[model samples]
Target: MHEKQKARDVMTPDPVVLPEDTPVVRAAKLMRDQAIGDVLVTRGDRLRGVVTDRDIVVRAVAETRDISVTPIGALCSTHVVTVDPDQDADDVVRLMREKAIRRVPVVEKGHPIGIVSLGDLAVEWDPTSALSDICAAPPNE
Candidate 1:
């Protein structure tokens, strides 16, 4: 039943989005404030890329970049894998597996509307699973 659901049905809507030129430090702060792992990078209303907390750590901190001045676009993963809102959730899962990605932006006309994560899938498809339990749990913070 859930497997047949569409991306729009399962995705977390109104995902946080930021401009490409925004500073990495600011993005990091926003992520912390929102308790979110990633932010969709946009350029003039068009989906550009996705930047995650991991990207900040590995690409900025580890690389000794100036987070206060470095633009998130510089570290964001631009070769993003996206799915349409009308796409099947099952197909999204398959694409995630094939791409080795944990999250995918749900786009419409090149604008991100939502995001679907592995955790979301677990909760939808196997609510009793350990992963689902963890995902459904309240945020540790």
Candidate 2:
């Protein structure tokens, strides 16, 4: 039953989105304010890329690029993988694993409508899974 779950069933609807041309610093600040790790970059209603807080650190800061001058597109992924709302969860998980990706955008008609993360798959696959437990576990001092 769990394996048959669809991407839309566990996806976070209306995820944070930004224009690809947004400055990296602005995007990072939005992420910080939202307390989210990633944002979907778009051009109008079309999905363009995905940018993570880690991307900013590893791709921009580490390279000594000026965050204020750098656009999110410069560091965000171009060939982002996506899943259909009706796609099988297993397939989504397989894609994520094969691509070493932690999340996948849920798109329809070239527009992103939602997003599914590994944690979402974990919880859907097994309610008492270790991944779920880890997500619930309190932070260590």
Candidate 3:
């Protein structure tokens, strides 16, 4: 039997990242340009938090923070669960399921190198499923 794939095998590498002090607006723009839902927030090379599109809507916009000047660190989710590159993808699925989260950063030596989402797991575990098909679809303009 083939060995199970590791997190590195299915992760999307070189994920968009920004410093904690970066303005929330910049992170929003990066998400729009990259067609990604979240950006990893860092303090130096260490992963500090994560900011998702919804975070902007709920935390910044709804709260009326000045997006242009508000640092992403102020609104980003600081408590994040991460996986190491060598971890089994199957374990990642379990972690996601247990945490009820859709995404997890893949870290190495305290720095993020990639991100893995529920969609990534769908593609790897069941390519023919509807979720996998949706994950594989190109982003709508």
Query: lDDT: which candidate is best?
Result: 1
CA lDDT for candidate 2: 0.88
TM-score of each: 0.95, 0.88, 0.95
Q: Report how far residue 121 has shifted in candidate 1, in Å.
A: 0.7
40-95, model 3: which lDDT tens digit per residue?
A: 99999899999999999999999999999999999999999999999998899899
Writing each residue's lDDT as its tens digit, candidate 2 over 18-130 gives: 98889999999988886678999998779999999999999999999999989998999878999999998788889999999999999998899999998777766667989
Mark the regions of model 3 whose C-alpha exceeds 4 Å error after superposition: 1-3
Query: Which pairs clash in model 3?
Result: none
Candidate 3 global CA lDDT score = 0.94
**Clash count of each predicted structure:** 0, 0, 0
Candidate 3 residue-wise lDDT at 104? 96
CA lDDT, every model vs. true structure: 0.94, 0.88, 0.94
lDDT of 1 at 17: 94
RMSD of each: 1.2, 2.1, 1.4
Better of 2 and 3 by TM-score: 3
Clashes of 1: 0
